[model samples]
Structures are given as structure tokens and as C-alpha cells.
Target: MSSTQKPVSSEDALGQKYDRCLADLLVKSGVGFGAGVVASVILFRRKTWPIALSTGFGAGAAYADCDRSFNPARIPGTRILPKAEAPASK
Candidate 1:
């Protein structure tokens, strides 16, 4: 190992994923809310359903991304490495 290289454990990797998921959730939901508000005001005549629908859509997308992050199999066209060739997370 080099002096500048730091070993990362599975726990650390999990934590990083969680942090990224949280950030994505917040950003996606916020953008959805903004879009919903704009649509509600201009197109829907201030209806509340558009706001909720848009926000839910954004949150759903974020959730899907978080799912893929934790479970690589959820991603399409990806094959699992053979156990012998896979790196040990520990």
C-alpha cells in the first residue's frame, strides 16, 4: 500500500452510499417541489394535487437510485462476478 492510499472498509462504503442517497433525495425532491409549484400556479390555477404528484415523482426517482446503489443486481445488463474473482469487501 502507498503512503497516500487509505483502506476503505465495507462499512465506510455503505456510509458513503447512504450519504449520497440522502443528498440525491433532497435535491430531487426540491426540484420536484419547485416544478410542481410552478405548474400549480400557472397551469393548474393553484391546485394542490400537481404539487404533490410532482414531488412524489421526484422522491420515487430518488428512491429508485438509492435502491440501485445498494443492490447492484437491480441495475440492468450487469453480470455478477464469479466468487473467485470478486474482491472481498472485508
Candidate 2:
């Protein structure tokens, strides 16, 4: 241990992670919701809640599973997005 360094407790680490995840969830969902509204308006030419909600959910899911096309686990909670897969060699 360094003289000026302090050990981080498990609880603190967990709290920090929780805060980050919550923030990510809120930001991603908000952006998705906004995009959905725009898309719905463009497609239907009217303000519709149902279509907007559906598209927002889809967009949020896409954001959570950014690495892959889709991930089922994303529906549960905000998750740290998975790492990108390495490109396959010929």
C-alpha cells in the first residue's frame, strides 16, 4: 500500500458501480425515447404513444446490447455492454 493511497471498501465499489449503471440506464433510455418519438412521428404522421413506447423499448435494447445485434439479458437491468468480438481471420 502506498503512503497516500487508501484502500477502497467493497461497499464503496458496489455503490459506485450501481451509480454508473443507473446513470447509463437513464441516459440510454432517454435517448431511445426521444429517438422513438421522432421516428413515430415521421412514420405515422401523428403523435402515438403505443408506437413510440415500442420503438423506445427496442432502441433501448439496442443500446444495451451495442456489441452484438441483440441480448436477452438487457431487459432485466442496465448491464455493462459486452466487449466486441475479434474479427475472424480468413
What's each prediction's TM-score?
A: 0.85, 0.52
Q: Tell me the tens digit of each residue's lDDT in model 2 across 5-28.
A: 689998987787666666666776
Tell me the TM-score of model 1: 0.85
By summed lDDT, which 10 consecutive residues of candidate 1 come out lowest? 1-10
The RMSD (Cα, Å) of candidate 1 is: 4.3
Which run of 10 residues does model 2 get worst, by summed lDDT?
65-74
Best by lDDT: 1
Tens digit of per-residue lDDT, candidate 1, span 24-83: 999999999999999999999999999999999999999999999999998999889888
